[model samples]
Target: MALGMNRDVFITCAVTGAGDTAGRSAKVPVTPEEIAAASIEAAEAGAAVAHIHVRDPVTKQGSRDLALYRETVRLIRASGVDVILNLTAGMGGDLTLGSVEAPLPPSAVGTDMVGATERLAHVAELLPEICTLDCGTMNFGEGDYVMTNTPAMLKAMAAQIKALGVRPEIEIFDTGHLVLAQWLEKQGLLDGPVLVQLCMGIPWGAPDDIGTLMAMVNNLPKDWIFSAFSIGRNQLPYAALAALAGGNVRVGLEDNLWLGKGVLASNGDLVAAAKTTLTSMGAKVLTAAETREKLQLKKRV
Candidate 1:
């Protein structure tokens, strides 16, 4: 345990997630340029990796458009940031059902479903070093909307992602999702040195409390490399907590937007803050090269 205990931890900055968060903070990057700038800033501040999601520039709405993803990746690469790019393949699976009395006719605007391959269209083309494979479907936020990732859909997507030579960072929102991830491993769909991200404190998912976090951490495969994060005000604290718990840390406007009360945070602010927190806990923060080696990621061109 001590030998593993002293290992340097990697930090990931979820630069701009595809969420309805633009109106909440002007700093939230909406377009490709803004997202790329944010990623560069996060890298300058200490993030070895940047987890990205693209949004429609005009509407500022989350999009799975290949062009948007292409532009975002291009901008980041052009900026010369030494950061690992992690694209989100978790889009195009929202399901919004009608009222229980009339469940047959689902809502139109909020519900977007597509084939698993369609969801990974951007990842297939860009071939980012890593992309997320959300392990299971779950209720999201205050809505009739539920995220819909059936096991069959996941299996098909996993096969395609593997075919593209991209590593899948399994996103587990709860204990059950971990069960599904392990099952995928058993079937050999997920490659070795599996990377998992424990998304804690998301609604209807795992809680941020110690016991719950520990439960999810304890259930992970011994050799699996993992990271963990919590949303909102708990974001910075989780950096120390994750490092102490033997996992990496994720922080950004995607999970939090305030450096302090009444102070809006840029992505760099969050990464710098998390780095400070990890250092205070006596944990060495690994760089992009070191993290890539530790995770067994291939070098990006």
Candidate 2:
């Protein structure tokens, strides 16, 4: 019916993700040093928050190493940049099931499933201002892979994160995940104002389309905060679109790698591009302090 608009918005830059993108682009940060550097560059380019995922420096694959998380956060803090730290608790839940013939046990080559307590080990140790809680499990991509997070698992993770005083950024892939997140809140497992990230354009998740995005928006809780983004080419467009939808924005190499069709982009370039788009749309992008106040984040513990 009516357009949703917010005069002020905040930009979140998801630095290096655990996906298999390191080989495709040299700009993807592998080690903690590079990830930290990229996050600072993003903040300088107008990202209020840095949503980070560490990779095994040796393998260049996404890792859940507490040591890696510690070093990454340390370097970012040492740099004296004021970017809000948002570490990912989305690791340790990947499951690649067995083939049809011999499906007795799931494949171990890709399955990294662990208990709820183990999944939040890094989050509890690092205590980032924000950490993601993937609300539900789904067929995440090609192969037999499933990103697993049962209601029992989510409840345990949310309670632990709440105890740690870190805000849980509920990663919403499908509509049902949103319903599950609300269920968690109703159970008092998740308290206070929550943040939801509408992750569209991923396979086996919500599609990246206007109607789909709007549907997710319409279903959002009246008082909860939200930010939306799509991967690849839709990434830049979603920055402005998310702002128009009355939500905050997210952009970085985590979702897309190109500054243009033929160009590879660093995190800074993506954040700068998103900032330009949002500004052209007449929305004032908020700084880290402003975002902190708006989100009501507690002091970093």
How much lDDT does each candidate structure score? 0.90, 0.91
Model 2's alpha-carbon lDDT is 0.91
In the range 1-301, model 1's lDDT, one tens digit per residue, is 1113434889999987878899899999999999999999999999999999999999998899899899989988887778999999989888998876786588897889999879999998898999999999999888788999999999999999888888999999999999999998898898878999999999999999988988888888888988999999999989988887889999999888899999999999999999998887788899999999998887776
RMSD of each: 1.4, 1.3
User: Could you give candidate 2's per-residue lDDT for residues 1-301 as a string of tens digits?
Assistant: 1347876999999999999999999999999999999999999999999999999998999999999999999999999899999989889898888986775499988899899889888888878889999999999666788899999999999999988888999999999999999999998877667899999999989998989999988988788889999999999999988988889899999999999999999999999999999888889989999999998997573
Regions of candidate 2 where Cα sits further than 4 Å from its true position: 1-3
Best by lDDT: 2
TM-score of every candidate relative to the true structure: 0.97, 0.98
In terms of lDDT, the poorest run of 10 residues in model 1 is: 1-10
Error (Å) of candidate 2 at residue 68 is: 0.6
Following a full C-alpha superposition, what root-mean-square deviation does model 1 have from the true structure? 1.4
